[model samples]
Target chain A: MILVMGPVDELVTAFFLKHLTDTKREYLFVDERHLGGDVRLELDLPQGPSGKGRLRGAVHFPTWRVGLEELTGIYSRLGTGNVEQRKTPEARAEQAHAAALLDLFPGPVANRATAMLSNGSKPCQYAAILAAGLRVPDTLVGGTWERWEPFARALDGDPVIKSVSDERSLVKQVSWEATRASARPGQALAPHQFQQRIHGTNIRAHVVGARHVLACRAETQALDYRHPDMTGHTVSLRATELPEPVAEACRRLSRALGVDLAGIDLIEPPGGSSRPEDWVCLEVNTCPGFMWFEQNAGLPIARVLADFLGTPLGS
Target chain B: MSNQSTDAGLISSQDLPKLAEAGHVAAPTVGNSAAELREAVQAALAEQWSLMGIIDTGKKASDLGKKAADALTDKGKEIEDKAIHREKDARDEAHRKMNDDKAKKHGREAGAHGATTNAFARALSELRG
Candidate 1:
């Protein structure tokens, strides 16, 4: 049985459920909106010899009680909105317990909690990307004016300033003039990430497991193409192909990041050359939203996910 | 496990162990109470959440540090402006002092020349006498 965890109202979740229904797969969904009412977890862990212990539990939903051992795979997009804001001790404890159980789930989880840690820090993600033999833009993190001034002066064009962490901060281009204007006579006070901006089309490659890759090309001039275009409409997405080496690099990046499923962002330089070396690795997104890719690329992402979970399409 | 059906879609209690026997499901290891299990899970989650919190706190601290640095930069700019003004005032004062000294020096030279002329005229008169 496959276990899906997330907000039921989420479009992604709905899509997955619809695909699962089409495949007639036995599955359970743990909705965040209903903790005690719609779902409750009763887990028991017994003391046993080392390496011999097994976790036993059942997640009771209003309609089903799913045995822990029956779970073949888990697709978790659990957000912290419902649990993170609770101040009560009971709620906190329940959430923590749920998280622990999730961590302990022994199945083909799309991503284990430990593997997801890299996304918390872009630097960590970049290191993984670099380890995968992908090129990352030159980056400077948290330096004083003394350091930034020379770096700014050396850059051929404006550098992109962004948050070092994963918080959604605007990718603002730092013109040489802006940097000079903002310069003060001391070390840089707060943490900022500056990268040599690469001019190219934004390519997002969704790597599913090791075998499946869906590449999408987006045309936009924004520093971050994830945001809407100037007309308040989303940037157009179309199915595209990557150079063989670049595709292999993306696969390697996915494995290095310990994610079976990931959205790997790359920049294809303006030149006609499709060489792997010409592309720059931006970052790996752990929980990528596939709504746009599904809508625009016409790729059956949900069906693919079902297949990854051991349920073939039209099973 | 009881054989009673608590919910419709759930597997009957009797069928659970049978499924386990069939190797469709593994037998559950039993010991801790549900509450204890919840507590354990919560403890584990707490650790994970704390780690996440640490990262978040670090980000916040970084942002605050940036804000403070920006404030310091603003203050520095203010001081820089004041210093520029002070430098300009000092330069103007020096220029005024130099100009005043030059004017005084010219005046002294003129006075000395006038005295010399007067003395010469007086000597001429005496000679004529």
Candidate 2:
């Protein structure tokens, strides 16, 4: 049996569940909203060798229960809803315990909780991206106007500003003068991500099971294709193929990050060759809402994701 | 040179209403002012378009709008319902015209989805931290 954890109504979770059901897979739906209420969890992991420990647990629903040992794999979207904002102590403990199980469960968790931590720090991911042989745009995490002046000067133009961490922010191109004019005297600006803006087509590659690579290109004049309205430009998405070397690099990056499934963003520079080094690595999303891609590009992301989750590790 | 490609639909600011029609994104309440309405629309757009990954593990669900699921705050929805009722009862011509203009500007019909709004995208952005 497979375990799907999240709000049943969330788009991505719902999409995955639909596919899993249509495929006739035996899976347990653990609704995060119902946790501590309609759903309960009991886990027992006695002390043992680091890798030899066995996680024994059972998830109890109103009318049924399933043992952790019976779970062949796990696909979790628990963070997709307000479950994390539990007010009651009981609710908090329940969520924490479930998260622990997701972290320690020795199976193909779409992404282990630990692997997902790489997304918390963009710079850290950049190091991994570079080591994976992908080009990382010049990025500055935090600095005052004086500190940033030289870095911005080295760029093609005013650098693009964005959120440093996983927090989502609009990617905006601002000139050095605009930044200095807005900065207060002698005070360090709040930590922000400023990176060299690469002129290219935006490509999102979904790497599944470190082998299946489905990619699409987003054609938009907007600095951030995600919010085309902000730039008054329409966005078109179409399925595309990644160059073999770049596709292989994405696979390596996913394996290195320990994310069984990853949404890897890249920028293919204008007039660039098919070489892996020509594509600029942006960031990897552990829990990608691939429904949008599937709907627009007609990529079989959901079906592939479902297939990946159904197969037990080392099968 | 075009890489291997397939036909995928387009998404843009103009496509906001289409998303509502397709039942993908929730239409927000028509705000009191044009600026507020635009904010609501952009927020809605951001809610639907921005590709945010898993929110912080322990943060509150204050940003549920990002997932584009659930109803807007109950209080806000109630207020929206009351405003619509008042407009209908009073037969306020100017109020109605203003709403129509706002709707046209945003490419969304005013009160399109009744009183309930989708999760507020601004709230979702704030909680993403």
Candidate 3:
């Protein structure tokens, strides 16, 4: 059975739902207050009356509904800040702890919750990818602005600054740099990521089962890799055959990370195009923009999904 | 255990578990036609382009409005530069025309006076100065 909990958008749900083949495989979803069953939780804020506090009426999770338990795998995309915070602290912790408990689930959880949470951190992911023997750009994260002069001298130009965590996305921040003249260095930069830029082509490799579908994007734009004003720039999508060694590396990486699927972003210098080994792994996306690839590439990503689901082991 | 990949896409929900029982799952015929897929891609691209256009139009309008305000604010400085050069050109042209008129009027006036009106002209030049 398929149990999808937390925030799954309708756009993705449609394609995902189209792939379910087994009738007994029931897909169930739940959040904090609605964990496969109805449970109303109200706030215990008190109103002071006659120098004493009185309990106020409680409030439940808004638009809450769930039918959990009768499912096998659980696919989660919830975050600490987004939907979970809407519930009370106790409830949020409860749901998170519950999701974490699913790693012990008999069937494959799309992502082992504990693994995802730990790998979800940028530093953790960077370290894991590096440890996996996949190449990643040399990144340095520090709060010291005093090192800028030397860093710039080493870089020969402005340092690319970005955010490491989810709330501060580097996708849009990749294009901008901290100029020597404008940089207030340490005083201005408290919680930000400044790394030496990697000059190369951007590649997004989506892995499903044993198949690896590669999407390469050369964002020759200013400020970010995914340019918001991405017009006039052309990007082509085609299936890239990764060498056996790299394919195994990706599989091993996925296995090691305990994720069923991952979208690994890589970069290769234009000069390094002659060899496959030259492709440097950038970062792995646990949840990728599958719709974008399905629209751009005629790979029948959805059908591939259906095909993958249509058959059982050795079938 | 969680749902397996074999659990998705029955097309018709009837006899769904028969797929698992058979142990051999049939690959869906949904992806075969390359041309059909190509058409779908084109249509999807067109729709995305339309959506992008709407978003771009809004952004462009906002940018244009900002530029219009900046031009309005900074137009005074540009006008001053043009006016300064214009004043110099007008002054030079006025002096040249004055000399030419003096030559023409002075010749006729001198003939009437049986003497050059250069003296009177000089007097007029001093007064003009």
Candidate 4:
């Protein structure tokens, strides 16, 4: 049996659940949205050395009492909050307890909460990627314009300025001339990331277990392809092969980050260079939105994820 | 009750490693072994050549051979001096271009600043009304 943890209405979750149903697999879709009909949790962590730990719990809904122990695999997409409509103290406590309990399940979880914490910091993620033998852009993180101005001037080409955190920030190319004019006193009070801009086409690889489903987007005039100009040259997505070393790097990086599934962003330089050292890994998205890539490239990412979950731990 | 079943509730550390390994996770090579091998071979050849020179140390250069060697050394020095002069000229040219680019950029920025200040003043006056 498999446990799918996340909002069931989410497209990725819904698609995977459909495949599981077609295969007649015994699975439970556990979301905070469907909590507390008669839901209760019981966990026993024995005290003595000889004592064995046991977790036996059930969520009693109107129609089913889903046993937690029967789960052999788990795919968790649980974001940061509880399913409760109102944010009460009791609801928060229950949500915390439920999240912790699920962490104890210990089967082949797609990603553990502890492992996913690295995504919270871009610097930490870059360090992990470097250690995994992947190349990362030279970065400068600073809070003051006095310090940032020199670094920006030293770069050969335009540098990319973005937020240091995972929060959505427009990745804009720094034009020293324009920025110098728009500069306001105390503007650099907040920390910002200054990365050496790389020139290349973007390649996003959805790595499901051991499989790498890669798609390449054509070069665009926009700094970020997500917000492309409609009248200008349109960006195109096509299935492509990753250089062997890059493919290996992606796999190693995913393992090092302790995420079984990941969406790895790689910058493939022009002239189609396959040398591993030439490619730059931008970032690894632990929970990437697959609907856009799936709709564009016609890749069966959901089916791949479902098959990976249904398979046994060592098989 | 000692429940030794593999289907027990939680995944153990031992179980997690097996899952990662079983997935055929790519283990990238830490260093270029082929390049290392080539370097090793080159060092060995260099040592052999040095040893061969030691064995032939008794060979002496003739007076004519010595004169030719000195002439070649003088020619090399002349070529080296010209190369150095050319390199210096190239460096100076590059430095000049960089300074020019910086000046042009600063001029553009100053112009933009003037425009921005004018726009801000206009907006402020409109808001006051």
Give lDDT tens digits, candidate 4, residues B3-96: 2211121221111111211111111111233233223323332333233233233222332444565578987566655644654455345434
Taking the tens digit of each residue's C-alpha lDDT, what string does model 1 give over A1-315?
A: 777765443335544654565466666666554454445777776655323126678887544466876677778765521122234555455555566565555445676554555665687687778877777998888887777778877887888998775444547787867776666665353688888988888898988875578888887656666544322345667888888878888888886665767888888888635566678888888777665566566666777777787643123
**Local distance difference test scores for all models:** 0.59, 0.67, 0.44, 0.55
Over 4 Å off, model 2:
A49-53, A82-84, B1-129
TM-score of chain A of each: 0.86, 0.94, 0.69, 0.85
Write one digit per residue (lDDT tens) for candidate 3, span B1-129.
112311221111111111111101111111223233223323332343343344445545654765665577667546644543554355334434433443342334333444213364343223222
What C-alpha lDDT does candidate 2 achieve relative to the native structure? 0.67
What would you estimate as the lDDT of candidate 4? 0.55
Number of the candidate with higher TM-score, 1 or 3: 1
Error of 1 at A40 (Å): 2.9
Candidate 3 lDDT, A1-315, residue by residue in tens:
354443222223333443332222334333332432333323232333322112222212234322222333455543311222334555555554554344433344555544444333466676667666677655556545566456555763456665554232424223224344455644654565566666776666666653545444544543344422222234455555555566666666665565665777777566555344566776677655454555444345545544433333233
Best by lDDT: 2
- Candidate 3 chain A lDDT trough over 10 residues, lowest sum: A50-59
Q: How large an RMSD does model 3 have?
A: 30.5
Write down the TM-score of every candidate.
0.64, 0.71, 0.54, 0.63
Report DockQ per prediction, comma-separated.
0.01, 0.03, 0.01, 0.01
Give model 2's docking category: incorrect
The regions of model 3 sitting more than 4 angstroms off are A8-15, A18-26, A31-33, A36-72, A80-90, A118-120, A168-188, A209-223, A228-236, A271-277, A299-315, B1-129
Candidate 1 recovers a fraction of native contacts equal to 0.00
Alpha carbon deviation, residue A300, candidate 4 (Å): 2.2
